[model samples]
Target: MAVLTGVSHAAEPLALCFAPPHAVAPDVRSQWQQELRLILHHSGYELKLAACTPESIELRVLRSNPRQPQALGAARTSQSRIEPVVEIYLDPLAELIGTRLAGPLGRAMARVTAHELRHVVGQQAHHQGGDFPEGYSAGLLLAAKPAHFRIR
Candidate 1:
């Protein structure tokens, strides 16, 4: 597992904790991390692997259930009196093998991760609609390579 902190000076502090899939290759995980950082960076946030800090938003990465229906990823807030945590399931993405999305798994995973992070930072689950919003899809952010990502 790895812990990452966002840009400190930002108005809201954020941290990302990643629990890599046991069966996944190390190189693939590295690629995902790289892409995740780059994608998040474009959103004007910095990420560093470390322990959770005071008042920092917490997010986690875990493997999803394979026995269930197809789900590329899922994220939700874990309500707690102390600190709430956001979790993103990755087993579904990890299970995609020899398929059309296999080639872009890393980028796809990054997109999913970015989507979840937006939820934590925005503190809401609203999508702008019209196909793909800021957190809903990476086609615009990752493909178009915008100067910065706006949390809408």
Candidate 2:
């Protein structure tokens, strides 16, 4: 299913929006959203992000599970098709980034978010290669900086 060249690898601009995270700082949210946008753009998408409508494919930022602070998050899917709702935890994201290299926490969060999103966009399963890797590591999250993530 290789697209080859001069072909699009993404769905035509879908209604992909994000739910504003409660109790999260505005600046952090802004940086996260901006970085997420840039990553998706670089990864070849033209999604129309906005406040969630019932029909929109929404990425909701939620509070982290206190017991699993290091856990990134998950995307809900039905059958083989990804569902409209994708949830990620901000507190855990910050915890994963940790105090080391705290500067890029927001940017790093974008990568983590994009990781989950690719699962939806590419209709991919874990470890199917590309952005849907088997798992994440601190080194990858903190040190690695790919120009753009691959979808497949």
Best by TM-score: 2
Question: In each prediction, how many residue pairs overlap at the backbone (N, C-alpha, C within less than 3 A)?
Answer: 2, 0
The segments of candidate 2 whose C-alpha lies over 4 angstroms from its true place after superposition are 1-14, 66-69, 100-103, 129-131, 146-148
**Candidate 2 global Cα RMSD:** 4.2
Q: What do the candidate models score in CA lDDT, each in turn?
A: 0.53, 0.67
TM-score of model 1 (CA atoms): 0.60
TM-score of each model, paired residue for residue: 0.60, 0.74
lDDT of 1 by residue, 25-84 (tens): 566557666776776666666666555665454555556635544554444545632234
Q: List per-candidate RMSD values in Å.
A: 8.1, 4.2
Model 1 alpha-carbon miss at residue 144, Å: 6.0
Tens digit of per-residue lDDT, candidate 2, span 1-152: 87668866664565677676545566766766677766666767655767778877777777775666666767777886777677777676766667524347667776777787777766765656444576677677766654445333
